[model samples]
Target: MPANLHAILSASSAERWLNCTAAPRYEEQFPETTSEYAEEGRLTHSICELKVLKKFTTAINQRTYTNRLNKLKKDTRYAEEMERTSDIYLEHLTEKAMGYDAPPLVNAEVKVDLTDYIPEGFGTCDCVMIGGDTLDITDYKHGKGVPVSAVNNPQMRLYALGALIKYEPFYGGMIKNVRTTIIQPRAMSEDDRITSETLSVAELKAWGESIKPIAQKAYSGFGEFKSGEHCRFCRGRAQCRARSETYTALEDFKDALLPTPENLAQVEQDGQDGIPTPAVLTNAEIGDLLTRGKSILAWYNDLENYALGAVLKGEDIPGWKAVAGRSNRTFTDQDAALASVIASGYDEALVYERKPKTLTALESLMGKKEFAEKIGAFIIKPPGKPTLAPASDKREPYNTATADFTGVTQEVLF
Candidate 1:
């Protein structure tokens, strides 16, 4: 298998390395491993590109599109959910393209070269559309675990900069603004599924200028090692000395002021006397503790994984040992087991229960257009329960008073 290669200053990790400038060099020691999730993302991206190309270009034949999709089906990760999500991505692009007065120039899998800002910097753009004075860059995100926003996103801005550089000669003076969009159909909240940010040409150019030095410093491995939430995806996170020192320092600080049972008792006694307890942390101190708590948790998880790996390899890790985890019993041969069960006594109907195909599966089997035309009216989506999210989330805040309770009724027992 070929090794998955990454650019030294790739747009995807701009958020990480830009913040923790020394992470790239630190991460260089570890080999890159492609997870099943990464492969699924690759497959979904390919599907999205092919679908977009088919819709935009007249030269592509139906057979070509079918062949591409058929090949994707061979991947174990391929599923109806992927097709549905990719369709939503394509729909977003199509809608954006249609809004233009003239037919927009839509390109998929666009190669963006960003050497001007970072050394040998380059990345592939999912979709790019240009018409009149506006350029739209849309990125398809397959992962639904975390919601991504386009506002001040380094990756998207870097893409916009590269796109600007690539098309400036052709669309100079005509392209005034760049719109960067992230389409994550699997996002939990409907509003969070699609988010956009628009930046003027002047703003993009200024941002490019600001990051030029930072990129150069990062390339030369001559920058400070600052740890933050960006460390979540860093390969060096487990062993990075800077990150270790950061967590260790914070832990020491926390230990000094952390409330204990004794301190709580003293605090309660002080409160009874109507005196403020000095043991309580200030607002700033509490905030700092909370921030460090997240880093500590992440570091602990990394340490646990490292220890587990060490133990598995017969390496001694002082206080830890690997052991067999719980496993559930399963039939060795499901088909034979089912057959034996049927022959003995159990009815086939009792053994297996039939279930209808999911909406996404049905749509994938039948063409999305035909499925919508025929069964669209049968679909009804109820409002989802409200959940807490960051203020930055695009979702509107749920209003308790405005919620419908028509179906709910009160009951009384005699």
Candidate 2:
């Protein structure tokens, strides 16, 4: 086995590095750190890979699965939720594989090389299955905060490009189309949980050619700095001068467009009759401001974190200083407190009310197959609330008229 190579323009960071060419080099100054959520994701991915491998290769046994899971469960963040979610991801792959006329060639944790399209670009596809004329690549997302879609997703496209390059020699002309799927088990709704996009080999290759120059420029650290939603996860976002300048421009532009003193006086006088003139903005100005607003808040948050971190480390931040946040009271000894409360003629139920296990926990306890067979019909999933997202996001526009509502209404009596 060989050690995995880290690419300067990794496929996972393609959206960020490709857009902000200076990000890769700038981000290199910061040390890589993983969060508890990231660790949980890694553990879940390991379980998914093992389960898939065991399906094809019998060398892996139940004991191997149990040992790996037992080790993962030792981590404080690990829970039955991970196992349930992993089962959903694995079941999706199995279902997709069964749809093929012939048995599909399934590969898990497959290394993909995208150096052809991006400079040293590479990533591991969670699941890749080839059958007849289709190559399906699936990526697992463990995060529940945001729903991921496969339509026009650069990461999946890059992975597909890499897979095509590696497997083309073996499959040749038999592979006509590539299908990319994103399985986000924690998505709010079932429909949003799975998203797939298909493209012909010619289309995918053309896209690869389109990004070659951008990747090369990023590789040489010679492209202009650009920022957008992609900066959300960029390590150098807080220190990026270009992003700061972009945000500053918004304020400067707004100040320059402020109404004159005479106009303000005229509006005040005109509003004496209870009708005031409304401030009007041109469509172009509105669009520009809207675009800037989307990123300004995120940039401000990043700046706050950076400044606070520096202040906490005893680094001078000019006018800022770290202060202890407000704290809440907690029991000094929970078990002893509970025992004393029970001894004082209080019922145990008053101290602790037992609740039913969550749907995920119950499913994990009873086994997904058995649970579904017995009580799947009781599951009811409500539609998710509409949220504002960038136009580039793949989610469909939410229609307000189609929203479901309960007939019962309560009137507030003030």
Output the number of the TM-score-best candidate: 2
Deviating ranges (above 4 Å) for candidate 1: 1-5, 250-291, 354-414
lDDT of each residue in 36-155, candidate 1, tens digit only: 888999999999989999999774789988997899888888887887888889888888888999999999988888888888789878999999799889999988888888888999
Q: Which pairs in model 1 have colliding backbones?
A: none
Taking the tens digit of each residue's C-alpha lDDT, what string does model 2 give over 58-145? 6578898678768877877777777778788888888988898999999899998777788667889998999989999999999888
Candidate 2 Cα deviation (angstroms), residue 210: 1.4
Tell me the lDDT of model 2 at 394.
55
